[model samples]
Target: MRFDKKIIKYIVATAILALSLYLSARQIAFDDLIMQLQGLDYVWVLYSIPVIIASNIIRALRWREIHTPLSTEVKTHNAFSAIMIGHLLNSFTLRFGELARPIILAKKEKLPFAAVISTAVLEGGVDFAFLIILFFISLVFLSEPLFKLLNFDSVFQGSLGIFIIVLVVITALFFIYRYRRQLWQWSKSILPAKFASKLEDSMSAFVQGFVSLRNPLFYFKMTLYTILLWLSYALIMYLVSFAFAFQSAIQLSFIDSIILVVFAGIATAIAFTPGAVGVYHLVVASIMTTLYSITSNEAFAYATIIHIITLLVQSCIGAIYLIYEGISTIKLGEMKK
Candidate 1:
C-alpha cells in the first residue's frame, strides 16, 4: 500500500470534518447537543443489538441468492461466519473484505476461491441497484423543488439524460462482467511496463472473481437479496428509533429512516475510509439535523449509538466464530496456505 497516499487521505478527511463542525456549530447548539446526548436513555442503544444481529442472519441468507447460479454453495451458518469476520476486518481496510470474504470461506469449506469471490461481486451489484432505487424514493419524500435558478430539473426532465446515464452504467457493467479478462489483457498491452505486470495479474484475478455473475439466475437472486437486505436494514433502524422515542413528528419516522439510509448509502459509497469511519458519522449527522430537524446533539447521539452498536454486535459474534474456527488473527497466515 502507498503509505503517503493513505496519510494524505486521512488528513484530507479530517480537514473536511473540521470544516463541517465549524460551519454547523454557529447554527447548532453544541452544549445543548452534548447535554441531550448525556440525558438520552442508553438502554435504547442496547435495543439495537437484536436488530443488528438479525440483519446479519438475513444478510447471510441473501448472499446465498447471489451464489446459487454460480453453483458455489455455502451453508448459511458458514456464510454468516465468513461475512462477519470479513466485514469486521474490512472496517480497518477499505474494500479489503471484497476478496477476503470468499478467500476465508474457501479455505474453511474447501470451496473454490474464484467461485466464492464471484458470488460476492454479484451480491455487491444487487446491493447497488436497490440503493439507487431507495435514493430515488427518498427524493420523492423530500419532494423539494429545485433551486429553480439552475433550471436543473429542466435539464434532467426528459428521458435523454436518464437514458444516457443508464446506458453508460450498463455499458461499463457489461464490459466489466463479460470481458473482464480481456480488458485486463488490454490494459497490460497498453501499459506493457515491467512494474505493471504484477499489478495486472492481481487485478485480473479480482475481475475474474466476479465472472460467476454471468449467469442469468445469479442476477435474479442477487436482485431478490438486495431488496430484502436493505429492507431489513431500514426496519432495524425503525425499531431502534422507536426504542428511544427518537422523534415522533420528524425524527425516526418510516420515511425519515429511508431517507437517512439513502443518504448514508450515497455518502459511504465513495468513502475511502474503513467502514466509512468519519464519513458515516458526518453524513448521518448532517442529514438528521438538516432534513429531520433533529437537534445537533440528538443527531450525533443517534448516529454514534447506531454505529457503535452495529460494530460491537458484529465484533462479538465474529470473535466467537473466530475462536470456534480456530482462526485467531495471529493464525490468519495459515488460512492462505
Candidate 2:
C-alpha cells in the first residue's frame, strides 16, 4: 500500500513538473534564454547563496524556539540539521520533508513525536497567516497595476471573500473547542473506545506543545524571528536581481522583489511539483512579461537561474547533513513511520 502511494505521488509530481515546463517553454525562445543566462553577471547570483544559508539558519533557530516549549532538550544544531535534511527531501519528494523533519528531531532528542508534530503544525499555521498578510500588503501597493495587468480583479475579490469565510469558520471552530467541555464527550461518543482514548491523550500532548504561547516575551520573540526569516528570503531575491543589472529594461527594485516573493510564495504553496519546478517559473515569467513588460525569454532565464541556485544550495547542504548524521534518504522515509 505504501509503495503504491509512493508511486502515485511520483506520477503526480512528474505530471505537474512536465506541464509546468511545457507552459514555461512554449512561450519563450530557449536559445535566447540560454544566451541571456550565459552572459549575465554571476557574482550577484552567487551572493544569494550566503543569504539563503542565513535564512535557513534563522528558520532553524525559529523552529528551536517553537520546540523548546515542548521539550527543553531540543538543541539548535539538531533542529538546524533536521530542517536541512527535510529541505533536501522536500526537493525530491512532494512535502515528505515536513514529516521527516519532526520525526528525525523526535528520534534524536527523545521527544514525543506527536508533540513535535504539533509544533510543526503550529509553525505552518503561523507562516500561512504571515503569507496572507504579505499578500494583502503587496496587493495594496501594486493593486492598480496588478489588477490591470492580470485582469485578476474578479479572482482577487473572490479569493478575499473565501479567505474571510475560511477565517470565520476556523475561528468559530477554535472557540467551540476551547469553551465546550462537552466537545470531548461528543467526540468520544462517535469514535471507537480505543480510538477515543488515544485521541484524548494526543490532544493533551498537542496542547501542551503550545505552552510557549503563554509567555508574552517568547511569543514576541517568535513573531520577530518569523518576520526576520521572511525578510531574509526577500533579501535573497533582491540580491539576485542585481545579476541581471545589465538588462536596463528589467528594473527590478526591492519593492518588485517583494512582490515577486509573494507571487512565488503563493505559486509554490499551490504547486504540486517537487520544489515548485515549472509552476514557479511560469508564475515568475508571467508576472515579468505581463506586468513589468519584460520579454518572456529574459524573465524565464531569470527564473531558471534563481530557482536552480536555490535547489543546488538546499540539496548540497541537505546532503552534507545527511552524511554527518549517518542518515540515508530511505532511513529518512522510515522515520516517517
Best by TM-score: 2
Error of 1 at 185 (Å): 7.7
lDDT per prediction? 0.67, 0.83
The stretch of ten residues in a row with the least summed lDDT in candidate 1 is 141-150
Using all chains and alpha carbons, the TM-scores for the candidates as numbered come to 0.76, 0.91
- Candidate 2 lDDT, tens digit per residue, 41-120? 99998899998989888988888888877777689889888888888888877888888988898899988788888888
Worst 10 residues of 2 by lDDT: 142-151
What RMSD, rounded to one decimal, does every model reach?
Answer: 4.7, 2.3
For model 2, what is the C-alpha lDDT against the true structure?
Answer: 0.83
